[model samples]
Target: MASDTASLRPMPAPERALARKRRYRRRLRSRIILSFVIFGFVLTALIASTAVYLRNRVEDQVISAALTKNNNVFAEGFYRNPDAIGVPFEKIQGRQFSTSKLDRVPDAWRALANGVHELTEQDPVTGNERVYRLAVRKDPDYWFFLAYDIAEERESQERLNRALIGSVGIFTLLSALIGWWSAARVMSPVSELARRLQASGDSTQPEPLAPHFPEDEVGQLASALDDYAARLTEVVQRDREFNADVSHELRTPLAVVKGAVELLLSRPDLDEKTRARLLRIQRAEQQCTDLISALLLLSRNERGHGATDVQRVAEQLLDAHRTQLGGKPLALRLEGSRELVVDAPESAVNVALGNLIGNAVKYTTQGEVIVRLLDGAVEVIDSGPGLSAEDAARLFERGYRGTHAEHSLGGGIGLSIVRRLCALYGWRVRVVPGEERGVVATLTFSAGNGTL
Candidate 1:
């Protein structure tokens, strides 16, 4: 007899709040730390590159000057004795060349264009690799070459590169620590503001927040919040006064109508049709009273719980609709559970379930409108034209009329009011296509503290 059913579970307030705070803090902290890390990386890379470039440039310049000076001394000594060229280099393992062709040198150093060139070669006597800087000079009678040992300079350069890498790593770690500390300092005030904002929700009147913060962005935000709170307080006060006046003014007329109907019904001469009409009037007045109470509760954004019988309310609504059915062939009936009770005010149950029943009666012309009460839910199934896709999608939107509402005398606000009531009472309301050829509107009450 039912299409489907769904249930919802509510999360505990404390856990939800804690999770939200953790997510917010993680995002803020990560952004701050990532920014600082990127800045540190870029700055370190720039400094290291500049240091390496300058070190290489300075070393190249000094080595070139030394090579030129040593080349001159070798050229002078070679000119003194061209035949005994090996005597000038007795203290160092130096090599001399007389022509541009370097047949005795390594193949890697054979192609030289008369400038300083560095090469690494193995020493035959020591069986160790030695780095040498070769300075080639073209003389009038011959081409002279001088080799200078630069293994110490190469070792120094390697040490400098290693030290720069180590410094970069150390500085990156320091930057991460500084970033964490700085982010904590920056977020402390904002966190305090958030804590205060959350605490303010429990109070009717919130304290001023601007005094606790210095004159900065956070302080300005606090001032704005103060202004907003003042405005909201004013609006709430006006709404309370208006709801009070409405309740007083509207209930007086309903009470008068109910009293008049009772007086009329007590007369013995009243016919059966007149008696039925008077009873319908009384039922309508009661419905109006319940509606006013429900609307007031909604406007005030408050909950009032009491023991209410779902089946009884559904029967009352169905009987009332039957009285006003005129000549229509629609049968309004209450089915399913007989004693399903809930922990909500009668007015809320009436307003929310009444809308669904009323809509079913209005839309279904010839078929039946069944009000079925389950364990913690009420389903109003109508054998009207099944809902279209568009109607099902925006059925509960305020002031939205369905495809079948072209000539209906309604503002399309009944389902909207039902949706809001469901939300206020931690209930869920959904309308879907029935199994055969109707629309089923289900209101599932939350099985929390407010439900029986």
Candidate 2:
């Protein structure tokens, strides 16, 4: 059950990239500024850490050397007098112990080598730990221990660390400001290039972008864009000319066929079957004319304005399909509102709505094809094989065919053209599965596009 539900869900490949991209995605300028800030922060931190390490090393070496020298002097003076009143230095405390009384030394200080050792001991009275640099000297007759106070040095180290931290923050802020300024300077030409390119796109002829920029990367990009635009403009102009020529050339034959059909339909002595065949030919010619007009509009990417009767177009489309049904036990229908009208050319309406109706008539084998008219929309519902998720998703894509379209005679661009027409006219169209069976294709006009 879970697998079935998962299979039915939307899991497009781009979802993962989109999810991760949102977290780390940044504008180009923002990324540049961030890079500068990170570089400044890391450099300052490394320098501050090195300064602290070197200061501590030098201070330790000096303290160790002084302690060793002073301890020797203290031992020498104590031995000469056999007793000393106080110590040689102000912050130095010396302790003398006989070799026989080794156990008298405190346990924390007993295992000392003949060098400097730093120890922290808590004072019993204040319950505060005091750091000391202890220098030890062992002799055959006596053992001497000298301790030096280093609390001031520790305090100075702390003060230095605080100052370094402040300096790092200051430098980072300065780097951020510099990065912002540099980014603005660097992006200015690109921004102007983009602005000019956009302006050129909206115009019939574009101005040369490379002329406005220096001979640099931006200029190179602008030159490339100009070349591409020129080629594209030529292609577009050739395409428009071809469509115009085709439309102009085809109208002559279609006009001849239309005149002949009208002349034949006027004959009163024609038999019923022959008249029906002539009417079918007339319908086919009309469909061809409407298709050409729609294609021309599509090529030009323009909308033609007129008040088209929805019911009349739907009835005409259904009648044409009914004749083409042949021996199939199928029915074509139009239901609901009869007063619906659209503010669009009849040929445009005929093409868009006709595609929907034609697809229904094609896929539906025996059941009915119903055209339902709403207030501002038309729905072509068919009692054929229902739509699939994949088909519904890609129904409007150019050159895409549904699963049931294997034996169908089409290039799979009818719905794509319909979609383009809707876009050009500010309308909407969609295909969805019907409630029970078959498919329902709806063509909805915008509020400004029609009247009930």
Candidate 3:
């Protein structure tokens, strides 16, 4: 019946919540940084593309205009001289004219049609690469070719391209750094809010959070939290007052009933039937008191720990069930380790274990309901009809009645309460089919500072 060591060590709720928040924050920061980087890269790519297109357009227009001007000047000069063809400008270092055969033109220029064309060739004297623009004209008997050197223009384009690439890299890095700083600035308020909330976990009165921030998204969130906290505090205050009033009003009557039962039990002349009924009444009163205390603790969302013996609580529950058996031929017994103890209030133990035992006794007609205590768990095995698939599936669901419980008297909330208590205390509770016949329910306690 005992739970495994791994099951005994569950993470605390606050720590788990904090870890989840941290993961969310990391994802948020990463998304912000990624968005900024992608935006910067895309914008830089667009601007660089536009700049390259314009630079290429301007370079082509300038080269074309220069080629046309030089071609006109050469034509006029050739028509005037006919024998000597001179360079038009100082930048026009190379000049070539092919009058009779097309073979006199460069091999790269022979395949071109008409308009100006750009080509790269090696200088014969300097052995350096030079770019040139060629303009061709055909007369009746000769072909005129004019070449313009554009090496400096090509060098300028290369430098512009290099500068654009370097700017893109530098701007991208700056954008990433700005994104990081912006994310930090944006998340700082949220981080402070979380810290304040965590620090207020143990406090009865929470500090105002809205006053700490400006009227922005974070401020609205802080204001909302403050409103929720105030409303929750009021609700808790009302719940505490109601629980206190009920305890005061109900416990007094229960104490009087207990005293009256004791007084009646002392009467020697009372009949056996009346005395038995009085004892049942006294037990009922005690059970009610325990239930009230347990319910109050649950409402307060608090755990009350004491040196509680598992066997002792089980025996008491069994005795209570035995009194209500009313001549049913059923055996209620306790088995296994008698020394198993846990650090929980007796009422909490009673509310948890009593529900299992009570359900077992209620459903079973005339067989044994055994309470088995192991290292860190208690099992309630009953020789009732085994649970059906449907019953087992939704057994612990609130307001769900088993097939056998269709005719029973209950709202089907006992197991739900037990489940809530287990979650509150980091315990585990489950139901399974018994070995031969019937069902077994186990309540396993965590091996924390309270387990023995």
Candidate number with greatest lDDT:
2
Which candidate order results from sorting by lDDT in descending order? 2, 1, 3
Report the error of model 2 at residue 399, Å.
2.2
Better of 2 and 3 by TM-score: 2
What does the lDDT read for residue 59 in candidate 1? 87
Query: What are the lDDT figures for the candidates, one per model?
Result: 0.82, 0.86, 0.82
lDDT tens string, model 3, 59-159?
A: 79987887777776777777787777666476664344555666777677777766688888888999998888887666665556677777887888899
Clashes of 3: 0
What is the lDDT, from 0 to 100, of the residue 93 in candidate 1?
40
What tens-digit string does per-residue lDDT give for candidate 1 at 241-304?
Answer: 9998999999998889989999999999999999998998888898889989988988888888
RMSD of 3: 4.2
Instruction: Encode model 2's per-residue lDDT on 76-103: one tens digit a residue.
Output: 9888987574585888898988889999
Locate the minimum summed-lDDT window of 10 residues in model 3.
Answer: 1-10
RMSD list, candidates in order:
3.5, 4.8, 4.2
Model 1's lDDT to the true fold? 0.82
After superposing candidate 2, which stretches have Cα over 4 Å from the reference? 1-25, 76-87, 100-108, 111-113, 123-129, 448-452
Clash count of each predicted structure: 0, 0, 0
